[model samples]
Target: MTLLIETRELAVAAADSIVQPTSIRVRAGVPFTILGETGSGKTLLAQAIAGTLPDGLVARGEILIAGRPVQDLAVHERRALWGREIAILPQEPWLALDPTARSIDQVAEVYEVVRRRPADGARDDAVEAMRSLRLEGAGRKLPSELSGGMAQRVALAASRAGGARIMLADEPTKGLDAALRDGAIDLLREAMGSEGGLLTITHDISVPRRLGGEVAIMLAGRIIEQGPVEDVLQRPRHDYTRRLVAADPANWIRRIVPERFGDPVIEARGLAKFRGGRLLFSGLSLTIARGEIVGVVGPSGSGKSSLGDLVLGLIRPDAGSVRRDPRIAPLRFQKLYQDPPAAFAPQLTIRRALADLVARHRLDATRISDLMRRLRLSDGLLDRPPGAISGGELQRFALLRVLLLKPAFLFADEPTSRLDLITQQEMIELIVESAREEGCAVLLVSHDRDLIDKTADRVLALEGSWMDRDAVA
Candidate 1:
């Protein structure tokens, strides 16, 4: 066995101080995992190893590849190593792909660039990889045209097509359903078996156990525990590891009585959306009673977001109608999008943003200030642009924006998808509390089974546009 990558006393910085400082080594034919809560700098560490850290952020450490220090390598040279010698699968699949280009062609370009082959041959390779991943018809579809899981599969295929000996993946299962997550894990394990060393950064504890390899649990930028998979998972030494395992909402939610305990605040019947020549859903019927937190779950492209839109009237349904109580006015049906920062104007100050919404909805200005306080946002964050705040903070602000409306029905689409574990937990708690406190009905959409189990009063499984009648009945 040989060390494919070695980082000695590696320290990463964002603005002025350190974020994640640690040392690790990647040995051939082994899977090395960086496990931690979100914002633990797992992505930063991967960037440091891949030599893709952005400017203004400094890295101090020795990054040795094949027994040679390559910290001083130029950007192009470092990037060249990717897809040829090394590769990375990022957490944000959509952002990773070229939204404007065909998914298959984008992947083909990777192989063509790496192998210096003709475009036709590279495309053939891309199509072959797609077939191997059980993705049919993906080769001709644009990145935006593919479903979430399909897009992710395409991204993975592109990363591996160039025979990259070392692979790094960040949160590969973040937004996928159980079935897709299993398929992705299988793909990764097989890729590692064929290519050698693999480094994956994930907050999901089940991932390490599934990979069955050497795992390093990180906390606050340091590896607190590292060992074989079974030994570590069976008897975790660190409190952080224990907390993560215990916090598996999927495990606890099954046994407790759901908190459906308040009033019918909102109703949707036969809601359906047709976009890009595909029917998302039709004749979908559901209701969120007062003080109820209902969760929608399914595989990628299951119409979760479309359902949210229908409930909020953000988009007109092609078929079924959505009717709400007279009290649930247009302004009262608030939405907190998955990407909160992108949902708002980047140039607008947070205060101005809230004020504009309040004025538009004829809300009292005092409600905005009180809502921010209730949402645990600092006064200092109010004047800052959406870009200045963290994803978690931005999401909190989005929630505050909704809270100000005192909405009767709330539509939250993958609201915690981009947040870290602690922040995700906090945000979920806040939402649940707010829904109960205000007697609001919440329609929560997420791929996280654990989240669904914990927060939902009732679960509605969406398979494309069709509801799982067996389960729902």
Candidate 2:
């Protein structure tokens, strides 16, 4: 196989050294993977390679594409190269796409802009991309119309259709179910293998293993381990790599999620939701008691987000009624989303945002401040705009704001999907503490099995149109 890209002693520094000088090579007809915990510079390294690193990020290293140095290329020049030779599937599907355009139009634009094609073949390719991803009824649908999984699939199709020789995918299976995740990995492996080269960046250990490729584990901005998938996963030499594998989200079921709080915190009977032409779920009966976390696990397109939306009243159920303590059900749930940056106004400081909420609700200010600190944030951070904070920090702030409402029921939808291992731990601990303090019932929706096993007392698996609820033993 020919070497497609090479990075020699690549070093990137931002707020300190995010990616210590590292070197790796990508050969055609293979999936070269970068694995690491969140905030460990995996994403940064991908950004550096793609030439889309955030401003103020200082990078030092040699990135060679086809034996040519690419660091000196202009932004537009890089774009031209990226569109035809490299493609990136960002971690956040919604953020990666435009909210206003139809899904088909967005995809068509990708082809037009990247392929520089005004030909009828572009539309044919776009539709084929959607079909390949199994995105039915998605061509004309807006990003908002599709479920989380559907939108993510559409994004993948767009990237694949770009026909780039190299692909960089970040957390590509984060919100997908086991089946869908496997399928996506297979699709990526086939595409890369058939045409030649692709590099995937993810915290998910399972991905590289299934794809059977060279794996490199990054930690504190360095490539700590690199080898074949079996060698690294089964006989990991690095301590950090071992830790990352041990904490794989798929293993969450081995640990026990304690039911320390007593009593039913939230109750619902025969809950059903119907919208457009789909039935999310019907006759869904369940109860969540205080000190108990129930995880709703399912594949994409199986209504995981829809279930959360029903409980939160973000979308009203057509048939079933939802009853929750008035004090706990906030119109806008804060803890469930990782990028609170996306929800906030760029001009509003964090302090003003929280203060405005407190003022509107006639709540005490001191309590809100204390909550923020407990979440590992500083009093000074409150003065900065949400955009100024990292994704993890924004998530913490968002969770704290929800806690400020002191809701009796917490509905978390894929709360850890975008978080690194450490942040995932912190957030889980915070959730347990808040549940214990308020005797609240927490409903968590996630694709990470390890997260479910460690944080939930019960598990519900949704497949196709069925939900099987099981008690955690």
Candidate 3:
């Protein structure tokens, strides 16, 4: 197999250096993954290869695509060669997608740009790409109209449409449910047949294993260990790698056992929701009690997030009622949305947003600092706008904004989905501790079966608007 992408002593620096000098090679037909915690510079490395580094970031060292040096190429020159030789699926789909245009149009644009096809041909290719990704009706919807997971699929569709020999996917499955994730992995594997290869940067430990390829464990800004997936994941050589592997929910020693139930804090009865005149869910009902965690699990587009919105009164139910305790203030029921980037004010810096929240709530600086520490967010991030930070960091910051409120009832929609294994555990622990110590009732919506099994006192499964109680063993 021919080497597709080679990085020799590649380093990316911003206001201050982030990724240290790192060397790696990706070969055709092989899948290579770089796994790391949030802010480990995995995305930076991938962006360096794609020549898409942000404005302030500078790349040093050498990058070669198909044995041709690209580090010296002009931006437009690199972009001109991108689709034919390389393609990048960014971690945040919103960044890659045009918010005003329909999803299908954006995907069609990729076909036109990369393949230089006619308009009708591009549209046909776009539809085919989306269909392959199980995004049947997504083409007509604008980026804002699609869910986080759906937008992610659209990005994948665009990347696939480009027909690049080498694909660079950054957290491609960031917001997908288990079923969708499996399908995505299959698509990625199929894309990396004998003709091409894939280099993915993700915190998802499961991805590298599923792709059946080499895995590199990145810590801080460097790859500390690299080898075959099974060897690296099963018998990690570095302490950081071991810690990361152990942090997987499968390896965790502690579990959250449901304690005795308390009085109901929030209740939903005969809830029904519709989007674009299509029924999302109907006749769904659940109750969350004080100091209880109720988990909702289902496939993508199954209305799990809509249920959270209903409980939090973010959206009105069409045919049902959400009853909140009179004692609970409006702010006492908060929601941590799945799409963290969309949840914040794009114009506001993280520092400004947090400061406003703190001022309004009269929260103490020390308390906020401690919570940020627990969430593994750096002080430097506070200065950056929500768009500037990675999705995981934004997710943590979103949670922090709500945690400061000390809400009596919390609706967390895939709260930890964007996070890496270690941070997922930390976030889970934090949520559980909040329920135990602060008597905060939580509606935990996620597709992670292990997480639901471990943290939820009761589980509810959603299928086409129908809700069924899941027996917890």
Candidate 4:
């Protein structure tokens, strides 16, 4: 095995230093992973090494790629190596995909252009890649038409298509279900055969655990502790690392089913939804009472998010009806979207968006500050556009927006999917507390079975959208 990437005392800074000086090595046939929460500067460090840092921020120290000095190379010289020698898979899937392009075209473009393969051959290779990831049926859909999970798969396929020997995957498993996440892991592992290198940045501790690599624990912009994955994850020296491991849902002490509920806030009767030339679910019936947390779980593309949409009336069911309590205002029925950035105006700062809501609704302005504190959002983030912040932070901002409106029936679709284990637990706890205090009905959808089991009152299990298996446990 050879050294693929090495950063000696690499650090990134803006008005002030963000990612503190750090050093690490990525070797062929071995995975070197960085584990940290969002805003902990892990992503910033990766961006610096990849030569994709934002305009204002600057990086210092040495970066070597395959024994060549990356810093000394011209911009074009460095870019030519992308997808040929190394590839980057970003944290947000939407950033990697183009809205106007079909899934197949977006992926095939990499092969035809970057790899210089023939058109027909590129298309064939793209099709094969998507088929392996169970995205064969979504090839014709635009990036906007795909689900979060599907879009994520498309991004993975496109990134891996160039056959880059060195791969930098940032939160690659963030939006996927258990099965797809495992499939992605297998794919990355196979791609890094004997002489390839992998560097993954993720909060899902499971990635490093399964990938078998050297792991570093990062907090407050610094690597606090690092060693073999088994030692760092299984036995920790840092207090933050131990807390992060303990916060994994698998380690959570299961609570008994939540207390019984009261009157129904929303109900679905014999509902049927047809999508992508297939019936997602049929003859499905569900009811969420005020203050009750109902969990929905299934494989990727199996309609977990679709079910929430049905209940929210964002999309009408092909059959049957969704009836909301007549007493509650329509404005009170809100949703925390799966992708937070999609819900916000890109041009407006976070503060501007919230202020507009406050002014329009004639709501008290002081509540905004209080809720920001509750969500652990920094005052500085309020000034930046949605695209400027990390996905996890943007997600908490989404929750703050929804909670401000005081939703009576909240459809939380994978709200915490992009978050770290520590923040994930905190987000769930906040949701539960908000639901109870406001008598809000929550339809929470998740890919992790343990999470659904721990938080939901009763589970709605979907087996490929067949409601026959929709049994409450």
Give me the candidate number with maximum lDDT.
4
Q: TM-score for all predictions?
A: 0.86, 0.86, 0.95, 0.96
Worst 10 residues of 2 by lDDT: 464-473
lDDT of each: 0.75, 0.75, 0.86, 0.88
Residues 157-223, model 3: lDDT tens digits: 8888889889999999987888789899889989889879799999998899899889899988999
- For candidate 3, what is the total of clashing residue pairs? 1
lDDT of 2 by residue, 392-469 (tens): 567777787788777667788777666666567777778877776667678888777667866777898766552222
- The list of candidate 3 runs beyond 4 A from truth reads 253-256, 465-473
Query: Distance (Å) between predicted and true CA of 461, model 2?
Result: 3.3
Clashes of 4: 0
Q: How big is the positional error of residue 182 in model 2, measured in Å on the Cα after superposition?
A: 1.3
Among these predicted structures, which one has the highest TM-score? 4
Per-residue accuracy of model 1 over 1-473 as CA lDDT, tens digit each? 78888999888876544455578888887788888765466777888888877666678889988677888888888877877778888766666888788777787888798878698888778877777765665566787666566677778887788787788888777666777787788888898784478899887776787888789887767788888888777899988887776766555545354544555766778777875556667778887887788889987766777788777777788988877777656677788876665588989999899879877878888776666665566797788887655455677788877777787888888787656565577678778877777787889988887788877878988776332211100
Q: Residue 454 in model 3: shift from native, Å?
A: 0.9
For candidate 3, the lDDT comes to 0.86
Full candidate order by lDDT, most accurate first: 4, 3, 1, 2
Question: Which residue runs of candidate 1 sit more than 4 Å off their true CA positions?
Answer: 137-141, 253-263, 344-397, 420-422, 465-473
Which 10-residue window in model 3 sums to the lowest lDDT? 464-473
Score candidate 1 by TM-score against the native: 0.86
Model 4 lDDT-worst window of ten:
464-473
TM-score of 4: 0.96
What alpha-carbon RMSD in Å does predicted model 2 have with respect to the real structure? 5.0
